[model samples]
Target: MRVLVAGATGVVGRALLPLLTSVGHEVTALSRTPRQGTVVADALDRSALHRAVREAAPDAVVHLLTAIPAEVNPRRLARDFALTNRLRTEGTRNLYEAARDAGATKVVAQGLAYAYDPEGEGPATEDAPLWRRPPRQFAPVLAALRELEERTTDAGGTVLRLGHLYGPGSSYAADGSFVRQVRAGKVPLVGGGGSVFSFTHAHDAATAVVAALDKPHTGPLNIVDDTPVPLRDWLPELARMLDAPAPKAAPAVLARMAVGGWGVAFMSKLRGADNARARLSLDWRPRYPVWREGFAAELNGTSDGTQG
Candidate 1:
């Protein structure tokens, strides 16, 4: 397969390139800035993206474009995700059209698994409705996600709705911003930490993209691990792994004052995702099936953290 990966330098994208090659696929990286083997073109730039896609002449195109910041403030969540929202909305449209024009047979794009409405009982399935009345800052983010998924699936493509990504180069990394906050006792467990989280290692996420390329599955597939843990469970465990002070508990009302409504919802109301459909459809399984083992390996330096 001749594959072109947009946002090739990103955390998951970096992990994906080498995996695709190991499985005997010709990979072309598309980036905004010039890299040795990458075709330079901003995803938001429609004309440039079309020209780049045409030049690559890929059989498949993977849309992993994002502009996420390293240190995200929950108070400014929407502002932080503004560019990423555009990538998911406008960028997806450009990529879909470009892929069609370039004669690509497959299109695989990234999505979020934790965007489901918080009123559910168990882990959210692929069909669960997105947050109907999200926090003011988060509403636009969900709108963009809906747009991305609809556009990709309407084009007969696959959307990998990944979970809270944790590994090298991700927010949960040892040196990452989230970890830094945890270490400084800045992140608190809010309202008994009831929100459940489903995690996906960057490497596992990359492999799922490879599987999507080889499989016949389309539409959204939750690419998460076997275990779904509540914030109270994972936060303390992550603190132990980092040798940091355990996160302190805070009332939801007070937390809202500090981290904003989005932060409180993130720590108290978010739902985890189920990966069963992805497992069956793509015949895929996560190497680190739970966050405990994955976090240990990543922080202990047993797992390779280098970007391609």
Candidate 2:
């Protein structure tokens, strides 16, 4: 299969390029700054993107761009949410249109698993309701996700809702970002820290994307690990792995004030997701099912130090 991957240098995209190649697929990586053979195109700029896709004439097109790096900064994080919202909405629209014009048969793109409502089921399935807290503020993001999924489904494409990403190139750094901040006693565990959250190693995420391409699954599939831990457990576990002091508990009132409503809620509520669909449909299983087994490896700059 000939595949055109936009944002091919991104976290997942970087890892995905190799997987697609390893399987004997001819891959064309698209980037804004074209490499030797990359097609220069911006997701926001429809004309350039259309031209690139038309030129590549790939059988499949993957949308993988997101405004990252701001995944930690408070202000920038909000901006990233808005920016990525556009990427999911406008970027997806552009890619789908371009892919259609290019005669691509399949389209696969990234979505989020943590967006599901954290209160309902013990482990929510793909059909669960999305997060509705601060409903007005997150309206655009939810709408965009819906639009992206709807379009993808309509085009016979697949949507993979990935969990909170960790490991290399993720915002949670080996020596900086959330991991470091918690280690240095800068971040306090919010609201007794009992929220259930899921995570995925970047490499696992990449592999899942590749698997979905080969499979015929459609609709949203959760690309998360089997283990979903509470903030209370994962935080201290991460601290221990990094040889840092455990986190101190912060008052829920204070935490809500500090990190805003959504942050506090996410840290203190349950948001687990089920991965049975992906596992069954795409023959995908996470290499690192839990953080304890792989946290140290990620800090050491490898995905479990056993990728073959």
Candidate 3:
């Protein structure tokens, strides 16, 4: 199979590209900055992206491009959310249009599994309602995800709703660009830190993306690990793995004042997602089932040697 991976330099994309190639697939990687074999394509530009897709003439296209800055900088996420929304909405639309025009058979793209409201059950399934009415600040992100999902899957494309990514290159690591501040004791946990979320290794997520290419299923699917960890538990465990001190707790009010609305929701809210559908449909399971084992491996820098 010939595959074209957008955002090929991204955390998941970087991992997925080599995985697909190792499996003997002809891979054409697309990114803004071209590498040895990568093509330069701006996903937001319809004509350019269309031409690139046409040139590659791939059997499948994996839309992994995201405007969200790496997780190390969660403090900046409020300002960046709008850009991410644009990437999810307009960028996704452009990718889907190009894929359809290029006669691609499969389109696999990334979605977030953590965006749903924490009002409902603990482990939300694909059928559960999204927090359509997010806080005024997050309204745009929720809107973009809704638009992206509708547009991608409308043409029989596949949507992989991934968990909070935490492996190398993601925001969850002590050395990750976004979350390093947390390790430096700059970012604090809000409220009681009771929010629960599912997570996946970047390589594990990439593997699922590759597996989905040949699967005969479509529509929304949760590509999460088997377990969801609560923030109260995760923060300490991650600190231990990174050899850093446990995050200091902040009063919810103080946190909201510091990081605004989205930070409060993320740090103190409760939400989890179920990936049973993906397991049944894709015939794939996550190498890392939860944050403890997988994050420990990542902190120990073992993920590089175990790409599969």
Q: Pick the candidate with the highest lDDT.
A: 1
Instruction: Tell me model 1's lDDT, rounded to 2 decimals.
Output: 0.91
Question: Could you tell me which residue pairs clash in candidate 3?
Answer: 71-171, 71-178, 72-177, 72-178, 72-179, 73-178, 195-269
lDDT: which is higher, 1 or 3? 1
Question: Candidate 1 clashing pairs?
Answer: none
> How high is the CA lDDT of each candidate model?
0.91, 0.79, 0.80
- For candidate 1, the 10 contiguous residues with the lowest summed lDDT are 299-308
RMSD of each: 1.4, 1.9, 1.9
The weakest ten consecutive residues by lDDT in model 2 span: 70-79
Write model 3 residue lDDT over 1-308, tens digit each, in one string: 98999877777887888889899999998877767777778888889989888888888988887766554233456467777777787888888788888888888888989888788867999998888667666677778888888987786778899888876667776477645765676656788888887987888888898789889787889888888878888777666666667789899887877777777888887588999999999998999886678877877777762367
1 or 3: which has the higher TM-score?
1
Give the clashing pairs for model 2. none
TM-score of each: 0.98, 0.94, 0.94
Which model is ahead, 1 or 2, in terms of TM-score?
1
Which candidate, 1 or 2, would have the higher lDDT against the true structure? 1
Instruction: Give one digit per residue, the lDDT tens place, for model 1 in 1-308.
Output: 99999988888998899999988999999988887778878888999999999999999999999999998888999999999999999999998899999999999999999999999889999989889999998999999999999999898999999999988898888788888889998888999999999999999999899999998887999999999999999999888877889899999998989899999999999999999999999999998899899899888877763332
**Model 2 has how many clashing residue pairs?**
0
